[model samples]
Target chain A: MVFENKNSHWIDPYTHKFKESFKDINLLDKKKEYWRFASPSIWYDKFTLKKFQETRSSQSIKFDVTNYNFLRFNDGILDTETLRNFINKNKNVEICSFESIFLKKDHWSSLKFCQAQLNAEKSYERPLALFNGFNAKDGVFIKFKKGVKKDLHIIYEGNNKKNCCIRNLFDFEENSEIKVYEHFYGNSKYNVVSELFVADNSKFEHYKIINQDISETVIYHFFGNCKKNSKVKTVNFSFTDTPVRNEINLYLEGTNCDATVASMGFGKKESSICDNTVFISHQEESCKSRQIIKNALKSGAKAIFQGKIFVASKAQKTDGYQMSNGLILTDDCEFLVKPELEIYADDVVCSHGSISGTLNDDHLFYLRSRGIPLKEAQKKLIQAFFSEILDEVSDDNIVYYIQNQISEILTL
Target chain B: MFEIKDLHVNISEVEKKIINGINLKINPGEVHAIMGPNGSGKSTLSYTLSGKEGYEIEKGDIELDGESILDDEPDERAAKGIFLAFQYPIEIPGVGNLSFIRTALNSQRKFNGKDELNPAEFLKILREKADYLNVDMEMLKRPLNVGFSGGEKKRNEILQMALLEPRFCILDETDSGLDVDAMKQVSKGVNSLRSEDRSFLIITHYQRLLDYIKPDFVHIMAKGKIIKTGGPELALEVEDQGYTHLLN
Candidate 1:
């Protein structure tokens, strides 16, 4: 169901642990909030406390709710009376902006329940100024299901003069898959931190296409987890996210786990940067991980890629590869890639490679000799260069779409 | 239809010249064989005629059809009906042979105010032409010259020549990499496209090709300058004496 608030649409609050099994239980008070932007492990605290109190009848620590709370409500910032009206509309459901809650009334919520819980919500305290302004009022909560897949596309556009935090709880179950193509396109701009969580044997393919059209700097934080035999692919296609940062930390807690990180970005004019920092743990044997990043910079634009891979002592027989290739279109177009691999297991196979270069003159002339004009010749060469990676795109149609984009970048 | 008068070329960035005081003329429907020893600037002359960059033309005039074509770019020269089948044809990835031919043909046609051919129509016409040359459709679809054997690349060059049908075609060591059968087949293709308004300038160090496509006139180039000009029988004499008698 589509949520059209008729006014505003922010992230909805969800309060469910995203997985069935838990290694730790939280001993915190229900009213207290953890540190701002807790690490991946602190998430266990949020999950344990909510699962303990929410299920009244079934004392079982395991529950799912997003599979049922697939209902749509108005999203976005609202005035005092408007928020009051929204809460009144969902009076029968446990509607709290700060806490992760599960309403067993919609299929969407039920889908989340199958993963681990309905929603694992994080509460954000609003500033005194946001009470009158449009900051806290615009936040929203969306709960997804276990088997069904949906696209959450957004253009984070318009003028943003204040700070606002957006939260979403996407819970999945075993033997389920979902793809979320989220785009963070802003015209005026604001900072956003979005988090996605997946359960064991469940897969989440997330694509964050960020475009920077803002006068102010924007930072986007992403936190995700992958369970045993689960697949998670995250892509960062950003055009100068003026300071876009994607922080992905995944835990392969089960044997035979697989995860991949692929990213492509372009920076133009006076230092546009993206820090793709990732930490994938090979906690079990027979896990595999691959990371690839391609960057092309122009007009003195700057880019940075910092990637980390870890093979735990017990992660024997694991396989991993990390690579980053970049092209500096102009002499001043600066690009730097830092890739690291930390292995504690002696039986693992891991490698990393990086390369940067300009266009080839001989290749250019060979095309010209065949009578292709200059621009068209570059298109062919560049297409051939990027095709190595683009051919890996799962969809043939998407390959053509990206080919056209490369053509567009060349034409400009 | 091609003439080079007082031609002087420098292959390096310095003022030192490669071709000095060269003068030659090639008429329509005539096969001009340029037999030169190694380091005689045979490749330089071909590239200069095709307007390759970094080669400084110190002095001279090159005329095609009575018009001075010295200032033209390579593609422009190509558009003006000039084709060069290189000794070592460059490989261009992602450019199919058929599309490359069609693009070259259409560019020339557009230069002369003609319409372009669509892919389907171009493919039909190309298939017919390739059949005449005994070429395959697979070669047309693959990237130009990529993964092609030496003889296959030469055949591909000839196929490109047939597709473009330029007014003045230069064969730069086209016979070097071909076997007897390939040389015969390529000669047959060229002979089929022979017309009164088109000319061939075949550069070779050996005279074996003269047996297939008999040249009407043969010019011997020594140290970048033409030292002897004769009929097809001169090729026979060069094969007999191996340029030793010509130098003497």
Candidate 2:
């Protein structure tokens, strides 16, 4: 039995595929190639299929989002009142739940297109993403109309829930531009999956802030499909004290597409583990992709980065680059990096580099010789190490928030 | 006001002695130059005075104002007004040149129990000093010496020295990578900082720089020791001939 319900809506067939795929996944497989640096047993033991009761906590939203369209989710459940208010205010954009979008019939093609993209090749092979799909409930669907420019804020706040799962789908139409800010807060074992579809000549910018409690765990998966002449940029700033994993997969399926995925993470406690796994595929000719990952680790913390760029046989003139840098502050901490470039095309430009070391002694001495104390000089260099990624962020408020978070983690 | 007595320094890793029994003294308002060939331990002496690690002082005492400062850290020594313009200025990416200098200034001020200057006040003073040294205001906005030309990097070191206004300054091979024009600009900057209460220890391999800065005393160093000490004429003699005659 592929699915328990046969007479359900279109979502049943889409989710049934994932349910079948989940049966073949073994989360406890220690010898898994992708999970070599980071053991899967840690998150596998913490996985829970039992859903938690939803709570009503509107006051938990801490960030100032008064200038943008905001959506708040408490314990994996959306606030219907806030969604309705946003839907009423924004007429050009179509925002609704997956179930409601299926009934619209006008958006059925878009849904099918996204599902086909996900089903193509090995895109949906990730076990955690499959688990999220298997247990997926109704998720929000946002479609930006042609040439629409707007900013949207999504807040995921948990009320001490033991386990929760969330899925969000974004469809960017041709010539449209949108910036989405996703903030994850509170205490919970969260498994989230976000799927994005960028049409021709469209632009999509994604910014994520993951600041969960020290006792909880977070596993996030991002899948982006970029079409002809589209541009997609995603920047993730993670300052979590517990085990957190971010897996990003982007496919350049059309010519002249450009995609950039960058992340900066901080881990300080013994239990802190931050992992970033990225795979970018250039299937079409003349496409470009960049992956930049950096992390600062202290105490007994550990961080891992596994990034790969694949250029297909037909992907001539393809440009792909990957860089992973780690700064280890203490003797006990560890940073593991694996950067790979697999190109089947002869006329492609592809490169990757990985470096992990402590703060530079010469730089420290130079600063200290100018009268800056040892501790302060260290902090300044660490801050400067992460500033390259911070300079890419445009929003002042988000930058300020991230700076404060970095300072707090450093002080700890 | 600055002195090194019976200073014996060994490379910490291999314990190979580099400075074998060196003694030097410089009173206030005097500029002293140490001219040496390659591998003569000139830079090591400067680094030792500035409290760089990896140099073991087997038998020595560095004194400032009649107080021993062998136990102080680099920053503590800086607060006591000891500065070393590195032979190769370290390149720190993502740290603005202006901000780094300002931080250094404020840190020294705070350590001396004086008030720190805000950005506006610091920028005003930095602009005035930077202009006098022929430093482009645009360069200060970039990361410190990251992609700067050799001349630009040397000039930046002088800019930092001017901003800190240290009483005891040590220039280690400051003329190694500078062109004629840049050398003059840097010499002018250093000359402007010379005052009645300040002293300098200029370490170089040539006498061309000494022609501009005009050191009061010249010492010829070879084989980890000073072989000859004389007035300014000693530098002219070394330049006219070489260190081989002095060593003989």
Candidate 3:
């Protein structure tokens, strides 16, 4: 059931109908391979559906994005007034509600694509996406015209015990480029699903930072599709003590396309679980995909990384690489890494690697011998371990922000 | 400046004594070289003195400037003006060489109640020392000793020693993996840091390094004990007659 008491104005009748109609689907089965490592049902069983009214604090938050467009989401609900202002200010960009696409016959294909993604068997394999499909109050749909270049900053903030779902769709036309910064903060259950479609010769840089309260549960799923010669880079930076599961799937459907998925996480508290799962599919010739994930777990925290690369039989000359490294900081903590490569193309160059261990004693001795304190040395090494992956992000401002956040995570 | 009396150390994993009843002392401005054969516990002595874990000190007292330092942590010992240059310098990826040295230097300064240097001030001193050692400033931008050659790593160790400026230095086979040219370069860097207020304990198996930086005293160690001690001529004696001949 969805939030029924609070004034969820954006919650349409279709969402309610979808929940009731799809009650028989067993998407959260514990036996499913996708959910095998992290059994969501354990937490799902303890949760009860209810309407939680979020109090608007007197302290308003402001982001320094004077040169960029900003969108705000309050507990899975969009601010229509601000959205209208954004659309009015930007004449070349098209931003609307998800339902608006269904009203126009000329955009029928876009709507069909959304429907197929929402109902596809593979998408349903992830229970959180299905949960979002039947509960999202409203979704934002953004499209860029040919040769359009812009920076969009999206903020998600909320609190209390509300169970909320959020959906976002981004469509980039040919030759267009966009850089997006999505920041999430709060203590609440969230089911967030985002779909990105990159057309030929288009480029997109998507940065997602998750810094939620330790008592919250977050499940985020991202699907990206790249066309001919298009490049897409998605980086996820997460530091949470609660249960946070991130699933990223990228499809290289067009020739000469390249997709890079890089993520870094730190689990810092007892029983804090952070799981990152990524799947990349190369379906065309000469397509390239790279995945690098790093995690540092301390205390009794646990971290898991599952990465899979799939090269189709016809996708010759595909270059796929995957690596996952985990730094276990304490004896009480646990880190598990699983890297898989499924290649059907004979000429493809595919490789995968996974390594997990504690800090090197010799390295530690070297640092301490030079007079660095134990704690300071550990922090430096841990930060350096993540520097390689952080360097992949081209934007210096975003990288700086991430570095500061990482420092905070360690201190906390 | 540095003294070890009746030092007895044993490995924790096994019941065998690695450092069996050794006594040594070094005054200020003196460079003492210890020549020992393989399996003579030379490394064990260095590790025990540097406060590495797992080596049980059965009976010993290590003193720096008349203060016992056997119970101090590695960082504490470093703060008290003791430095060890590892035989095999470790590679720490992702940590820039300049940053590591600055951190180490500032950490000591902080412990000694001195103000830390700003980036500009630190860089100025680093450039001076690095240039004096003929070390490329570009190499400082890379990770600490990562991808460095054998000689480069040894030079980095000396660079750190020069920056930290410890009162007492322990060199653990710093010349084992270097050619003649590289050895001379490393020795030159070490000699540049020599002063009346500093003392050094150079541990090596060969006498070649002595040609560049002459030692005031030389000792022969065998079976975890200081079997013989003499002036610089002892190093020549060992060089002319192998360790086996001297032991016999």
Chain A: TM-score in each candidate?
0.65, 0.91, 0.87
Top candidate when judged by TM-score against the true structure: 2
For each candidate, report its DockQ versus the true two-chain complex: 0.39, 0.80, 0.82
Each model's Cα RMSD: 11.8, 3.3, 3.9
**lDDT by residue (tens digit), candidate 1, B1-248:** 89999999997666567898789888888788899889888988998888888788888999988899888877778878888888998887656666667877777777778888888888888888889889888877888788988877888888888888888889998888788998998888878878898999999989998888888889899887999999988998989889878887
Expressed as tens digits, the lDDT of each residue in A184-241 for candidate 3 is: 7775567787888889999999888776342466788788778899998988887766
**After superposition, candidate 3 runs with Cα above 4 Å error:** A1-22, A42-67, A81-85, A88-91, A99-112, A115-120, A212-215
Candidate 2 residue pairs in clash (backbone atoms < 3 Å): none
Per-residue CA lDDT of model 2 for B82-189, tens digit only, reads: 999988998898787888888899999999999999999999999999989999999999998989998898889889889999999999999988889989988998
Q: What share of the true interface contacts does candidate 3 keep?
A: 0.85
Ranking by lDDT: 2, 3, 1
Index of the highest-lDDT prediction: 2
- Local error of candidate 3 at residue B225 (angstroms): 1.4
Residue A15 displacement (Å), model 2: 1.8
DockQ of candidate 3 against the true complex? 0.82
Candidate 2 Cα errors over 4 Å, as ranges:
A1-7, A44-62, A99-110, A113-124, A212-214
- Per residue, candidate 2 scores C-alpha lDDT tens digits across A59-154 of 222568887799988777788977998998887798876445546545634544345237333733577777777675546788899898888999
Error of 2 at A235 (Å): 1.2
lDDT for residue A10 in candidate 1, whole number 0-100:
24
Candidate 3 chain B lowest-lDDT run of ten: B239-248
